[model samples]
Target: MVEPVADQVLRAIDQVRERYYRLIVIVGPAGSGKTSALQAVSALTSAPMINVNLELSRRLLNLTERQRAIHLPRILGDIVQETAAELVLLDNIELLFDVHLHVDPLRLLQRLARNRTVVATWNGTVGPNGLTYAVPGHPEYRRYPTGDLVIVEAKP
Candidate 1:
């Protein structure tokens, strides 16, 4: 039988405890139950769950485009720090891929995971090329090698 996504994520979190960046990406297309799986994991572990888009948007509401690009990294760091949880679950991370943000989404996640475990929902797919967000030619499209990051596929 297939393992549950939440269970897989929990296992991945435990597995990456010794890594420099404790990040486990749950990759799947929209409506693929990524959020549900995150919610499940949060409930199971009593970890805090964050809706990235909602939280980041609220924090960036007053910043100009240039200021946003300059301050985004620090702002994101503050957000994660505010959670005060050793393990943080993040969903709706589409904002990090915004071209205007001038951020490398995957790298940003890795940075956040450096201090604590991060299990985030990625609206994308994984394949031979690596992890992908959106299609090529799309403004938000991004791809990255898996590297040391652990991935849990959220199959529909």
Candidate 2:
């Protein structure tokens, strides 16, 4: 149900990149072209890229509650400045976890959403209220549209 990446999407992309829209949530599944779309956008624009592979030791994507507190933010900020990137792109955001046992991407999301453009990749489905789900029973995300998060759905 993800709306095609037509002129509207392209325009949205331009609006965020050109005019500096704080948060650009690219909520989509593994192969939803979230990364690719961001890449293409970055390539075409002056945005820098910051791809943090959360596959290090933990399997979460939440920025808070992680024992590696101090350095991560510094590193993320550095990455942002390093690329002089106006747009920040995140991949495999499903790993963003929190102590609440629910995926807590708020801190990180809020941080980036504050002044930069962000597009994240996740694994889940589109829920009723334009939310993204890691699994059907898990928590839902209202940051982006469901279709935008899910690329395809295989019927059971």
Candidate 3:
């Protein structure tokens, strides 16, 4: 039997405890149950789940494009800090990939994980090139080397 995504993420959390950046990214396509797995992990571990797009959008609503780009990292850090949880689950991170944001999505997550464990749902795939979001030639396309990040695949 295939191991459940939540279980895989839970195991990853434990495994990254001593790492500099305690981040576990759950990668899958749309409708792949990444959110459900994150919910399960949240319920099981009592960690707070954050909707990144909603929260970040709300916080950046009144900011100018330049302001948003300038303050994005600090805003994100504040959001994570507000959770006050050792482990934070983030979903709907598509906003972070917006070209206007002028920020590296994976690096933002890594920065957040420096202070606490972060398990985030990534609507993407892990390939030989590394973790990818969207596709080449797409406005939001992004790819990053796996580096020290732990990854959990959520298949439907």
lDDT of each: 0.93, 0.49, 0.93
Model 2, 90-115: lDDT tens digits are: 65554344223333464565476556
Off by over 4 Å in 2: 1-9, 14-21, 54-66, 69-75, 98-103, 136-156
Give lDDT tens digits, candidate 1, residues 58-113. 99999999999999899989999998999999999999998998999999999999
Ranking by lDDT: 3, 1, 2
CA lDDT for candidate 3: 0.93
**Poorly placed runs, candidate 1 (over 4 Å):** none
Best by lDDT: 3
**Weakest ten-residue segment in model 1 by summed lDDT:** 140-149
What's the TM-score of each model vs. the native?
Answer: 0.98, 0.59, 0.97
Estimate candidate 2's RMSD in Å. Answer: 6.1
- Arrange candidates, best TM-score first: 1, 3, 2
- Candidate 2 residue 82 C-alpha distance from true site, Å: 3.4
Clashing pairs in 1: none
For model 3, residues 1-156, the per-residue Cα lDDT tens digits are 999999999999999999999999999999999999999999999999999999999999999999999999999899999989999999999999999989999989999999899999999999789999999999999888886669999886
